[model samples]
Target: MRFQLGWSLVWATLILAGCASSRPAATTSGRSAVDYNSYNEDLSSTRPVYNAPLTNVTPVTRSAAPSATAPAPTATRKNEIRKPNPPIEALHVNRELDLILDTIAIKNRTVRYAPGFRIQVYVGNQRQDADAVKLLIYQNFPELSPYLSYNQPTYRLKVGDFMRRIDAERYYASIRRLISSAQLQADKVDIRRSLLIK
Candidate 1:
């Protein structure tokens, strides 16, 4: 009886002591249950969509592009022609160019500024015959200007202010052809304007 009483008292004391010192046990019914199955499966990220507000702008109502027809462009200045202008006569250069000008004027009929030569017509024939020859020469070529001289024993006929011996030789050949036996002598005589004119 004594042992049974001791064991009962010890059990009663343990029960009271646990009740006094510990918190109450929680209930599982009211709260949501955590899904343990989600821990194993793949789930996409959950982001918010379409947050931008309406812009409040007016819609543009464009009419047909300024009717397909327009007038041609006109030149502003009065002198300018509507169509392309004709090409100018010549293009003008900006600067003036210097040119050579002959300053000295020739005034007299037969004057010699420079010393030169003349050609003489040779005649060993009589004065009358030489005059006949001269007449024939003067008639044929009026361009040839001649001067006459007589030393009594000889009748000398001369023509031209020939600048070169070759010119005299040329004239001599022509004269010899006409006069049959005419000769040529190259001499340094004065150049005159009468030869140029005739």
Candidate 2:
């Protein structure tokens, strides 16, 4: 074991010495291996020298000044007149179009209702009861304009034109204090009136 250890140390020392000797020795000039001075010398040799004579240059001649009696040049413009565009005939709409427009106008004038939900604040056969409920809603919650509409034997006082049941449900929760029996019902809702209420 002692013999083997001594042989290993000798092998390691030999390997290290071989590696050190294989590398190139550094120069004493203290310059890098790139030799920047050679590159600078090459650049100086290729550079152009500017010691040529100015024999090719021509002398500039000055012109005489214009006399005060001579008139200055004036720019003249050609006369150009643009012609007017020809008149086009007015559009002739069909009578059927007027009928269609009249129909649309009549539809706009008529109460256009959408399939929506409303909170029924009161539903009774008595007109006075419906009016009272309407007045109660108007006085207490003016923002929610209660609509009073009669259908045959009964008059319903519905509050708010909710496009969705969720909206009616929300409004019902708020007005539940005033009208505990208020319930969401599908009704013909006026979109314009609903927007105005908001």
Instruction: For candidate 2, write residues 15-72 as lDDT tens digits.
Output: 9988785535557886445555566335777789977433323343333764598543
Q: Residue 107 error for model 1, in Å?
A: 14
Worst 10 residues of 1 by lDDT: 94-103
Alpha-carbon RMSD, candidate 2: 22.5
- lDDT score, candidate 2: 0.72
Off by over 4 Å in 2: 1-111
Model 1 per-residue lDDT tens digits across residues 21-93: 3544444775445555578643545655655432332333334653457433334345432433323432232
Q: Which candidate tops lDDT?
A: 2
Q: Estimate each model's TM-score.
A: 0.37, 0.41
Weakest lDDT window of 10 consecutive positions for candidate 2 = 74-83
Q: Which lDDT value does model 2 have at 192?
A: 76
Q: Each candidate's lDDT (Cα)?
A: 0.58, 0.72
